[model samples]
Structures are given as C-alpha cells and as structure tokens.
Target chain A: MTELEFDYLRAYLKQRSGLALTPEKRYLVESRLTPVCRRFGLATLRDLVGTLKVARDSAIEKAVVEAMTTNETFFFRDRTPFDLFRDVLLPQAMARRAGQRRLRIWCAAASTGQEPYSLAILLQEAGVKLAGWQVEIVATDLSTEVIEKGKLGLYSHFEVQRGLPVQWLLKYFTQIGEQWQIAPSLRSMVDYRPLNLLNGFEALGTFDVIYCRNVLIYFDTPTKADILGRLADRLGPEGALLLGAAETVIGLTDRLSPNPQHRGLYGVAAPVVRAASPVAPPVSQLRVAAR
Target chain B: MTNDPAETRTCLVVDDSAVIRKVARRIIETLGFAVTEAEDGSDALLRCAEAMPDVILLDWNMPNVDGYAFLQALRQRPGGTGPKILFCTTENDVGAIARALRAGADEYIMKPFDRDILTAKLEQVGVVQADAA
Candidate 1:
C-alpha cells in the first residue's frame, strides 16, 4: 500500500475505533486488513481504500475495524482482579448497597464475555450474600462478531483450559461434543452489547464497578484520558474501577484516582469513607481457591 | 525429560506420543520444573516409585495400564496422592472428563496444547506459582 493510502487507513481507523496506529504499523494494517479485503471481494488494499474513498460499504468498514482490533481474552485472566473482586469489591458492595439491594457492573471491553462471565460466576459463588439482590452485568465490546459469540456462551475445550479452575469448569459449564457451554443461569446473568468506547454510554445509566482493562492501551493519550473521564462519570460515588495490570489513571486523568491499598484499582477522585472494606482472605485460602 | 537434581520442582510428562511428551516437557521446564518422561502408565508408575514427581502430566489411551487404571492405582499407593495429577488427552467427552476428575486427577488438559495452556494448567493445579507464569 502507498504511504498516502496507509495514512488514509490510519486516520480512518483512528476516527472510527480510536485505534492510534503509528507509521511503523503499516505492515499490521496490511496483514490484518488483507483478510477483510478477500472477504469483501476486494482484490487489494488499493481497491479496499478506493471503496472507502467512495460511498463506503458499512459491512466492509465494520470488517476493517474488527480486523484491526484484537479480541484475545480468557476466563479469569490476570487472576488478581478477580481475587480483588471476591476479597474486596464484593464485601464493600454488600455493605454499601445493603439497603438498595441492587448492584450493577459494567465491563467496558468485555472481549468474548469471559470477564463478565467470570464475574457472574463469582457472584454465583457469593451465594446468600446476593440471594435476593438484583444484579446487572453489562458487557460490551466493539466487535459485533464477539458480541454474538458472547451471547451464545459456548467455548472450546482449549479456550476453557485457560485460567479457568477445573471445579468451576465442571460446575459452571456443560460439555457438548468437543466444546463447553456456559450454564444458562450464568449466561443469563450478563447482558452483552456492541459498544464503541468513543461513543456515548449515558443511556446505560451508572455502574457500581467498571472494568475497562487492556482496551485503553491501544488508544492515544487524549483518547485514553477521554475514555477514563467518561468511565469516571459512569461510576457511582463509592464505586470502583479496575484497569489492566499495566494501565493506570495517573498522568492521564484527574477524574479518577488510584486506591492506595490496591495496585490497579481506581475510583472517583474523592475521599470516601471505606467503612465496608473487608480483610482479604488468607494467602493459603487463595492458593487453594486457585486450584 | 531429564532428571536435573539442581531443579527444585519435578514434572513427569507421561504420553505415548513422543512429540506430545517432548512439547509438554519443553513447556513445563520453562516454568522451573525438572522434567522426566514416561511412555505409558506402567512406566509412569515405575517413575513415581523411584522418586515421586511433584507433578504428573498423564495421558489417556496408553499401551498398557491406561490413565484411568494408573490414577486408581496411584491413589491407592501411600504417597500417590501427594503428586498433583493433570489428566491430558484428546478425549473431550464430558463424562470422561468428570470421571478423570473423580479419579483423583487434579486438573484436565486437552491435547494440542502450547506453552501458555500448559503453564495455565500447571498454575491452576499449584504446581507453578500463579504470578511466576
């Protein structure tokens, strides 16, 4: 592809998906979009760009954006966030929302539903604490393809092996042929939607906990700050936000602040009484839980 | 798999397929394990008798003393239950997987696994440190 064509593609991707592709990523653009070209019956990147220049085919554009985005994910990925959810976040929510009896969680970049499903399993394990409570897990991703897959709640044997505890596997998923299907009860817990973070989420209302992990790293600093600011807007007064292990709110936005006690946890930049904070379970108990 | 006395953790890769065993050994070794290889369940039992490994990657459908029998035999032994057993096979049936778990297998691993998958399973079974992976 010519430099001009690459520039146009880069600008288009940035505008549509907030993907800030550097000049060196021209090869990545070619490799990822090449399949989209074939799928859309375009002969080459030149033809694809030509189509984009003219009145664009919505399907082709969607394919291009989805191709550029990576959806690599698995259940209970990174491990610690889930632990924090069980050990800290849940107890806090239980105490804070005891009167309301409602808890809402938003997974901003919930790729293929694992993050939300894992959270749902934890809620299921929470048992009596959440017995009659109304819980809503809103899982959103940019790709409609993944959203459809997430709705099905089916996973391969290989996919389930990643980061999923064996006992949880047996309890939460039923094997079908060569794949496993999430339990219908757990599958119903999450409401999956296709959402671009650059767009508005005001209609979805506020959330008690927001997980916008790993997705921000692809965006430029401005885009990251904008998304973080909006995420903070969606969070409740005492709600929590968890980022990817490598991501943080510092230097990006002042709307959210890091919890001194937690590593990747963030919340609205205010001094809120953490009266509901519970002691983390013993290390031995966590080790046993991992098994 | 080689017995490296200097290595603190030991893993026995038991598979009839040399390729699978070799692949699993290479992957497990990276997780700070001294790997040892056994072709079938009988051979694995002998290896366990010599010096029980901290982890066993057992394969089903072996030539003699298949994985299920080996698991049953191992659990019956005095120090057999000490080693964390990960049942590895191409069998994807739900019944079979539950059976293995019931037979004292610590975890289950599907075939065609890579380094990441092996590491995840090992971490799940506590053979490798979770953060270490």
Candidate 2:
C-alpha cells in the first residue's frame, strides 16, 4: 500500500477507534487489512482504503476497527497479576467494600475472556465470604468477534495451556476432543460486552477495579491521555487500575497514582489540581519492568 | 513393558502450563511409569509428602513458588528418600542448565523437544529400560 493509503486508513482508524498507528506499523495495517480487502471483493488494501474513505456505512467502519484491533490473549497470562489480585487486591477490596455488600470489576479489553474467568475462579476459591456480597465482573473488548469468543469460553488445547493451572483446568473445564470449554459456573460469572474504549463508557457504570493491561502501548500520547482521563472518571474513589507492567500513568494523567503495595497496580487518587490545569505532577510514577 | 522391577519407576510432573502437563503425561505413560501432576512448587511438595515418586519432571518458571524452591523443599523432607528430579524446562541457557544440574536436577530437557530425545534421557536415567522399546 502507498503511504497515502496507509495515512488515510490510520487517520480514519484514529478518528474512529482512538488507536494511533505510526509509520513503522504500516506493514501491520497491510497484513491485517489484506484479508478484509479480499473478503470485501476489493483488489487491494489501497482499494479498500479508498472505499472506506467515502463509505458512511457504520458497518464498514466497525469492520475496519475490528480488523485493526489486536485481540491476542490466553488463559492465566502472566501469573503474577492474578496472584496480586488474589493475595492483595481482592482481600483489600473485599474488606473496604464490606459495608456495600456489593463489588464490581471491569476487565477493559478482556480478549477472549481469560482474565475475567481467571478472576472469577479466584473469587470462587475465596468461598462464602463473597457469597452474600453481590459480585459482577464485566469483560469488554473493541472486537465483537473476540467478545463472542470470550462469551463462549471455549479454548483449544494449546490456547488453554499458556498459563492455566492443571487443577483448575480439571475442575472448571471440560475437554471435548482437543478443545476445552470453561464450565458454565465460571462462564456465567462474567458479562462480556463489545466496547470501544474511545467511546463513551457511561452505560458500563463505575467499577472498583479496572484492568486495562497490555493495551495502551498502541495508542499515541493524546489518545492515552484521553483514555486515562475517562478511566479515572469511571473509577470509584478507592478503586484501583491495573496496567501492563510497562505501562504507567506518570506524565500522562494525575487522576491516578501507582499503588505502592503492588507493582503495575494503580489507585484512583484525589484530583491533584483543577481540571483546567494543563499538567500536574503525577502523585507517583513507577515503571514496572516486564517479567 | 519391562519385566525388571527397577524399571518400574514413579514420576511426578510439575508445571503450571496445562499443555505441558498433557504432553508430559503422554511421554511418561508411554515410558511405563505412573505419573502424578502438580501446578506449582507448593502443590508439588504436598503431593511429594503423600507419595515420593522415583523421578520428577520440573518446570523452572512458575508462580506462588518455583522449581528451585520445590527442589529445596524436597531435600528438607524427612527420611531422605527424595525422588531423582529432571528439570524439563524451556530455560536453555547453558549456564542456567549447568546451574540447575548443580542445584540437583538429574537431567534437563528443553521446550519443543523431540520425543525420541526425551525417551533416550529417561532410559539413561534407568527409569525406562531399553527392552521396553
């Protein structure tokens, strides 16, 4: 594809999905969009870009966003985060929310439902202390296709093996031939939704813990700033945010601060300055090296 | 199957990855040994306390405890009848493998392994008799 075509698609995608694509990622667009072009009967990515430029159809735009979004994930990825959730986050959250008798968590960009289901299993293992409390876990992704897969909770042998524990697998998953389907008890605990992070999140409501891990690296500075602002607004006062080990809110937004207790974990901080301020010193900035 | 009683060894499989467990189970079963599995080091130690296997296939990377901790725990157990352990892991750095062997791994296997190589290693360890082939 020509630079003009790449720029056109990048600009369109940025405007639609808030995902920034740089020149180095031009090949990524070509490779991913080539299939879309073929499916649409367009000769090439350039042709597809040309058609998309004038196409006012919402379906076409949706398809572009879906094609552009990367939804790579597997069960129990990077075990430490889940350990932190079970050992530190959940216990503390449970104690603080004891009065409310309810808790809410959102796994933003939850690809294929692994993270949310893993969280549900952790809570189930915690037992009756959580029984009386109303618990809801909402898992969302920009790709409708991946969201469907997440709801289905079916995984191939290789996919399930990535980080899942055998005991949990034998207990919560049933193997049918080479594929394993997560049991209904675990599947029913999470509500999967198709959500574009750039869009309004008003309907999703506030959450006590929001996991937006390993996702923001694709976005440019401005998009990250906007998404962080929206995420901060949607967090409860004492709520927490979990980012990818390499991600941070430092120099980006002051609405959230790094949680000292857990690496790659952040908490909603009180507004440091009025919204009108261009930038405020981040309450705390710590870069968690990837394990 | 081997008629030699010494070849009828027990093996424990410790890995957090379900895929690895499934593959290891098939390999160990084919070698004519009873296999038990644990997800992490802590769980493996608990299993070890109940039944001491003749050999263990341990993965290096795991959460809530790891292969090194499990090895140490095994040595600390009373009676000193600890099973021989082979570190079957993806950590292929020569120095790391040497360190693991020094730390008490009887053998080391790399990831994306050939079944023939694994079987040869098992035979070398006397867990599987050559006649079993």
Q: Indicate which candidate wins on lDDT.
A: 1
lDDT tens readout by residue for model 1, A1-291: 999999999999999999999999998999999999999889999999999989658998899999999898999898888989999998998899999999999999988989999999999999987999999999999999999999999999889998898889999998887788999999999999889999998988999999989999899999999999999999999999999987999999888999999889998997555598688999999999999
Model 1, B16-104: lDDT tens digits are 99989888888887777888999999999999999999999999889989999998999899899899999988887877888999999
Off by over 4 Å in 1: A271-291, B1-7
Candidate 2 segments exceeding 4 Å error:
A273-291, B1-133
How would you class the docking of model 2?
A: incorrect
Clashing pairs in 1: none
Clashing pairs in 2: none
The recovered share of true contacts, given per candidate in order, is 0.68, 0.00
- Per-chain TM-score of candidate 2, chain B: 0.89
- Give per-residue lDDT, candidate 1, residue A3: 94
Error of 1 at B8 (Å): 1.7
- Residue B13, model 1: lDDT of 87
